[model samples]
Target: YCMSPGIVLTNACDSVRLYGKLSLRRCNMDDDDVQWPFEHEVLLSLTHPAGEAEIHLQVDPWRDFGWYRKPSESNNMSVCYSLRSVDLDELTRDGYVFEDQLRIKCKVVP
Candidate 1:
């Protein structure tokens, strides 16, 4: 698993477009072992108050996993993922001024 941190911003009344880059580290598992390749998935969970809109940028895991595969498994081993909408239109009535900040937690799992 890998941990990445980044900053995102959204317009006060408009749907915010979240865009950023995340670099995942390669696992140190040995090369010649039967488990020569390790596969994992990345899940993004975003939370905001009621009446807020959520948006996401599409990313290709197969291409992103290029740096994580073993030398011999480089072409054959890759990561795959699916985007599941946990919830949408969650009601949030809070208001904030410009420069106001909020926190959301993100995690990557195997």
Candidate 2:
């Protein structure tokens, strides 16, 4: 698990300050062209000094592999996850804020 800071802005100059951390656990995946089940979690914390701000999370899979194919064809293989929505306030109330703990499950195919 690692911690990082991110800034999100809503409506022009109006921005809400928040922070989140990512956790990556080892998952079992077969070495074949099939989707495997994987699980992970993300914790976040949002603070609004004015008490009128909204916070959102963006989850993106960071791939560390590349594809190889014939040069004549455009062989571009990339796998990533899009940002998913998670209620920050609800998560915070449940003690799943930044620095806290959370769990997420997913499936990957290759």
Candidate 3:
């Protein structure tokens, strides 16, 4: 599993875009046994309030152009999504954002 501490929201062509980074790390216990260049499909979804539908995004580490391989202790990749991917205003109006906080669900797919 990976975590994105911050997501950058910017205005682009009359719409909004979200940019963030995802990374993989070498765990102390599993580094030796686990394979290098961690390649797993990760699904991230923004949860909606009152059991509404979620906004989903998929990340494939294998397509990151060698950035997925661990050089030192961790490897990183950049990710971005625009209106073509998701609607920000619609999500906000639907209660996806609450108290200035957004809920994101992550799932690792092998």
RMSD of each: 8.4, 11.0, 3.5
TM-score of each: 0.35, 0.24, 0.69
Q: On residues 1-110, what C-alpha lDDT tens digit does candidate 3 reach at each position?
A: 24443355668788776543355544455556654434555677777766677776765555546665554545355442222355567667778878877777776667
Which tens-of-lDDT digit does each residue in 2-110 have in candidate 2? Answer: 1223333223234332333232322243335433222233323343433445354444444333322111232233222235444445556645444653333222232
Clashing pairs in 2: 40-104, 44-98, 59-83
lDDT of 3 at 63: 58
Q: After superposition, how far is residue 87 of candidate 1 from its true place, in Å?
A: 17
Candidate 1 lDDT by residue in tens digits, 1-110: 23353433334354543433344344455445434223444444344434364333333356445555444421332233333222112212233212354344444454
Name the runs in model 1 displaced over 4 angstroms: 7-16, 25-38, 49-60, 63-65, 69-99
For model 2 the local lDDT of residue 7 reads 33
lDDT of 3: 0.57
Candidate number that wins on lDDT, 2 or 3? 3
- Please state the error at residue 36 of candidate 2 in Å: 8.6
**Best by lDDT, which number?**
3
Question: Candidate 3, after superposition: displacement of residue 85 in Å?
Answer: 2.8
